[model samples]
Target: MIEIKEITAEETYPLRHEVMYPNHPFEYIKLPKDQEGKHFAVVNNAKNVTVVSLFFENDNAQFRKLATLESEQGKGYASKLLDFIIAYAKTKNAKKLWCNARVNKTNYYKKFGLKETHKTYTEAGIDFIILEMDLI
Candidate 1:
């Protein structure tokens, strides 16, 4: 079984470092106001954290540094985690939940009802498009 639960930012660093920022410095995975953001992870029956996502702010929750173990991808863990985060954001009275999704991954976010916004940006040689879901 996969268990999704809240965790400290520090606990998520390892997975984020390995899956999201492997070529960059360890600190590259760390975002500002990280402690203020609520972190969550999907732990498998083997007790390994296979997915990580961070949700921050109340009225406008933002997801960042979402990463899943390479070996564990495509098993629906990320989708499950996204489902949980959506419910969680609702509880926090968020009007919207947004993320900077990689160009290639926009379809994945679209599956969760997130629409692409006009905003665009680039980082580390990769382009990102803004995707957001209205909570109300």
Candidate 2:
């Protein structure tokens, strides 16, 4: 069985670093606004965190640092977690839900109904595009 629940920003660091920034320093995975965002994780039956994501709300809701353990990929954990975030954002009445998605992963996010905008950028040598789903 797997469970999804709110976790601390610090609790998200390890998975984020391991999956998203393995070559970068530990502190590189720490978001500056972590303290102001809500964090969540997916824990497997073994009680090990396999997926992590951080969300922030303003006029629109934005999610960042979404990562899944390399060993746990292709099992639908990230999809489930993203569904939960979308539902949670809707409950808050956000106008939209967005993320800075890795360019290569844009197709994966499109499966979740997120559309890419004209916005694109390169950060840490990785190309990213702004993806958003209208909520209202």
Candidate 3:
């Protein structure tokens, strides 16, 4: 079975580094969420898991460093975790959600009611588009 909850400090920060700065290792940018933000994990009975940090302020939330082991990719873990994030954000009274969606994942985010913001851009050598959803 899989579960979702706040990301702990132990492994998430490093994993976010790997996700955002995979090529070079350097300084870690500290954020308030690092020690107090929410996270969701999908784990099996054997204890293998995938975790992601949740970021938010006011009526907005961003899903970042959504890392899953290569072995677990294509298993719908991201979507499941995203489902949890949206629900939690709603409970927190969030009115919007933003994601720097990889160009390839735009369609996926669109399925969740996100619309392209005419903000196509590239970052970290990955083609991306900014997507936003009106959650309220």
Candidate 2 error regions (>4 Å):
46-48
Q: Candidate 3: deviation at residue 5, Å?
A: 2.7
State model 2's lDDT: 0.86
Q: Ranking under lDDT, best-scoring first?
A: 2, 1, 3
Q: Which wins on TM-score, candidate 2 or candidate 3?
A: 2
Over 6-70, each residue of candidate 1 has an lDDT whose tens digit, in order, gives 88888888898998779999999887788888888888985545555556564799988888889
The CA lDDT at 59 in model 3 is 75
119 Cα displacement, candidate 3 (Å): 2.0
lDDT of 2 by residue, 94-114 (tens): 889999999999999999999
Clashes of each: 0, 0, 4
Worst 10 residues of 1 by lDDT: 46-55
Q: What is the C-alpha lDDT of each candidate?
A: 0.86, 0.86, 0.72
lDDT of 2 at 108: 98
Model 1 residue 28 CA deviation (Å) reads 1.0
Better of 1 and 2 by TM-score: 2
Minimum summed lDDT over a 10-residue window in model 2 is located at 47-56
Highest lDDT, which number?
2
